[model samples]
Target: MELVSLIIMVLGLAALVGIYVISRVSRQHSPQKRDENIPVLRDADGNELSSVCDDVAARDGKRPSANARDMSDVMMSNVSGKSKGVHQPIADAVALPPQLVLFIAADIEAGFSGEEVLRALDNAGLSFGDMDIFHRFVLSAQGETSLFSVANGVKPWTLVPEELVMQTTPGLSMILNLPSQIDDGDAINDFLLTAERLTADLNGILKDHNQQPITPALRAGLLAMAA
Candidate 1:
């Protein structure tokens, strides 16, 4: 009886140990898929996560892993063109406590720069937002499409070189100045509506300026942002 009990206990512990190891290995190996096309990362709690690519790295050996995003160290990545890739929500990923930071981005067509954004915010009388919001919008254009004539016709938004940021995802967005931080429901609604208006205006400029037909996905994104 005693021997049988000991064997059962050992097997139970072994199973637990195996499960733990598997979980650890999973996190180390699986890259986080970027889902929200909204640009920046907000916690499941709706708070803005630091989108700065502080620790994006591919594994050196057979078992690949990401560069750690601790404040002390920084790394770079070829995939995200930065330090780390995203990891999906873990078990602890619950709706954050009381308040979370919101991420608002300006499309490639909109004039979203530090100075212009500041000018807009100041002109708009908005505050509490920062560079994280305004400066790092990832811009994507049809590389095949030439905008030389369009460039002459209408100047697309430009950011300072250092301010030009990339994302782990395939798309583009801007992280503007954190001059006005809006939290949750109302803030998100206002932000979305405003973004739509900006895109509608940009689409007009693209049509008249470059005689470009905005792609379906781009138009969809614009409409979603507006909605």
Candidate 2:
């Protein structure tokens, strides 16, 4: 009986020791608890998690990634050339913001002298608005066109004497200056109409910088902008 009791006590002690070992091993292999201080980063749609490696690099003050830097440089280059291309606005043809110049020229072989030219200007129903001793003349709008005025003190448009015409070209050229800084679109268009009429009266041709004829279609388009 004593031997049987001794064996039972040893078996119970062995069972308790086995249970302790299993518990300790299971605890050692179990997953650790999540840390609450770490944030869970997600993409824009929350469909997937974003890489936290970038955050780590940023925190360390490292330069941006090579792909990011390359994209930035490309965007900046495009912005730098935005105003330098042929993609200018259509409105610029009629109303140049800074300044606009129109050259009206007539051939001198029309059997008319400079005195006749001055007389035609007087007979063209044009009122003299301003004049400069430097042979600059500002013609006034004869009718409703006179209603428009520029905000600045700048004289709208004037015909200035051309020394070049006096020396060459077998004709006379007049410069119409419309610096918008001193004149408005209405004034500019009104002056252009006067120039065209006077050129026709003097039997002169209106030519542009490239000597191209000023077509009626182009003049109509610019005049239409006033309405």
Candidate 3:
């Protein structure tokens, strides 16, 4: 009887140890939880428009701009067909130019050097053109159509190399107006790729329209808009 009791106790202890080991391993491999306090921008239908990551917020030390909030409201109204008294079809809604905006910002302590900014812009295939800003063009059936445009973040936004030399800017704003002559999806893809390249070249943070760090979720949402 004593021997049997000892065997039962050992088996129970082994089971508990096995369970503990499994739990620890599972936790170690589990995905990290997102911070609940991070702000999320959603449309009228509760579809997430964009979100600010905690790490980005900490790094930027800034909140989303009022313009971003206003844009979100405008998008929601467009999506819900509330822009006009009558319900508008999604196809018709997409016909209107939906502006996709992104930002490349330098570190808070220092602004981008004029030489570096000009070099980055040139490398990204932007040419100084209309509005005294830089424009990215793509060839389509209609000939060269504007894919996107880049402007200095500072007042009187222009990207002329000579003008850039006069003043350092904290960032640049890249805007893509959709429903151009080219395919929207292709245009969006090119726009994002160019923005990413410019961001890398300038060593700047790539932020969404809301001026928040671009996360995978935000990227997907932006792509969906083009679709």
Candidate 4:
């Protein structure tokens, strides 16, 4: 009886060992599973890094290329607020006041007296109160009709150097300071006739501030002052 029980115990032990061997062989012959320790790549901003290639390559200790590094640098610069963009400049705007001015330059011979201009204005039935040297001449008209003047040129009151003083000589030109006080074509016609007659008497050529001949174009523009 004891011998039979020992044989049974041996057979049971061998069977357990055989089962353990089969399990070990099956495990060894089966596919091996690699342990992957993927790193969550992120900037200092705590964003997760992803993508199969980047994650796998990073685990394998492989780095990106030069262009990739440059792109990363640009992205980092933008994230860090170190990048810049194209900028533009602004310009100033200026406005001019609603003041109308007209000029009638003249061509007088040398040695022409300024007093002759004064006489021409007087003959037009114009009167004066004060003489502003810078404004050169100002003649008052009847009933707020208009105030006019005949000066060397436009803004004749401007002081010139002795070398440039020839520009201010009488008979060189005359500027008629005509303010748009009358809104009638007859008034403009009368003013033009008076200026024309005076300029004819002085033997001066009638021109604009630019010394361009006063054509019908100029006359039509001046007519708007009366309107």
Candidate 5:
């Protein structure tokens, strides 16, 4: 009876060891667990943006190739034209309130030349105006309605053409005041379109209020604000 008990104990120990070995092997062959908290970027249509290599490069603090950056420009270009049909007039004497702002930053290490930004602004139809910044205006039966404004990304936020002739800035800031006299949807769309155009022309990066690169999720949130 004692011998039988010993044999049974040995068999149980061997079974336990085998189970442990199997678990170790399975774990070694299993895929690594992904971090669930990482934000998944998607466009308006739920299409994913950026590639694994781009993510990896971003994580490593390496600048992505021009092709990768151009992809974002293409995406912006496709949606930038939607604001053309929104032509509601805004009150000329409306008071300015707190504003929602977006940034177009130069991706190059040396930043953007003032001349380049000036030309881009001209092409986008933003004229230097009140407060030393650039303003976009829409003509209507009432008169000219300001759609949005652009300022220098640097401090003072003004674009004095004389100073700009010799100045080099990191980028430009686009500002839109909410709850204004203009149609919110139209204003936002026009603002985005202008920003997109400037970004493409300058080969810059479009950033959110926080100055981080604009993600698809962020883009959706911006569009939703008009709703």
Candidate 6:
């Protein structure tokens, strides 16, 4: 029994020694590395340790590419709540009746309602000019309307940047004629902003007056005015 116990202890110690020998050999064979089993390079005198990652890695990690940075900057600029007050287009402002007529004509041609046109205009903050008039009034069966038709005959609603396709209906519904006393000389800052204010002009009148709720498309359009 004494011999058996001694043998067991000696075997345990021998196993421990073998493990230690293996660990030491492994450490010696594979030196300490930063990561990925790749060793850090030592400068002369071993003071400065250079990593596997180079200056390119540092740059890629820190700064975006020029185009990416520009796009990011522009996008950030768009929604940064900058006040673009009442930016009317340089075109001659047309009268409300003519504008209404044009809107009606465009809607009729597009198989949409006057309401949709009005809402889009409000969202776009667009106004009427000769081109605007022409587009709204003179399209054939499958044609687009002018920016003026989209805006509800409001002055200074003319800062609509071009390229807004005369979409059929607003995906979102908004109240165009919310009871706000806006003047002719109202400094719009941004038409869409005014439109949102107009849309919010509701207590009971909105449910009673507007049948359709504002569509997401129109909401997107209004937000797009900032862009």
Q: What is the C-alpha RMSD of each candidate to the true structure, in Å?
A: 23.5, 35.8, 16.3, 44.2, 19.3, 24.9
Q: On residues 1-227, what C-alpha lDDT tens digit does candidate 5 reach at each position?
A: 99999999999999999999999999876544432112333445555432221212332243323213233343343334234433232223122223555778877655778999999999998888777878898775578865667877765667889999887777777766454447766777777778889999999988855467889855754554443
Give candidate 6 misplaced runs (Cα > 4 Å).
1-72, 75-112, 119-127, 133-188, 195-227
Off by over 4 Å in 1: 36-170, 173-213, 216-227
In candidate 3, list every pair of residues with a backbone clash.
none
The sequence of per-residue lDDT tens digits that candidate 6 reaches over residues 35-108 is: 11112233455532212112112222421121122222332333332334423421221111100010111112
What TM-score should be assigned to candidate 4?
0.37
Query: Mind giving the per-residue lDDT tens digits that candidate 1 earns over 1-227?
Result: 99999999999999999999999999866655432233334445555343332211112211111212211111111112221434332112222111111223333433233444344333433332222222211223522211010000111222222343221222222221111233223333444344334334333221100123334443333223222
List runs of model 5 lying over 4 Å from the truth. 1-98, 140-142
lDDT tens digits, residues 48-119, model 4?
Answer: 322121221332243322112232232233323322331221111111112222233344324233565555
Worst 10 residues of 1 by lDDT: 146-155
- In order, candidate lDDTs are 0.30, 0.38, 0.64, 0.39, 0.63, 0.30
Clashes per candidate, residues 3 or more apart or on different chains? 34, 0, 0, 3, 0, 18
Best by lDDT: 3
Q: Candidate 3 — what's its lDDT? A: 0.64
User: Which lDDT value does model 6 have at 130?
Assistant: 40
- What shift in Å separates residue 217 of candidate 1 from its native position after superposition? 12
TM-score of each: 0.22, 0.36, 0.57, 0.37, 0.54, 0.19
Candidate 4 Cα misplacement greater than 4 A, ranges? 1-111, 131-146, 154-168, 172-179, 184-187, 220-227
Highest TM-score model number: 3
Where is model 6 poorest over a 10-residue stretch in terms of lDDT? Answer: 96-105
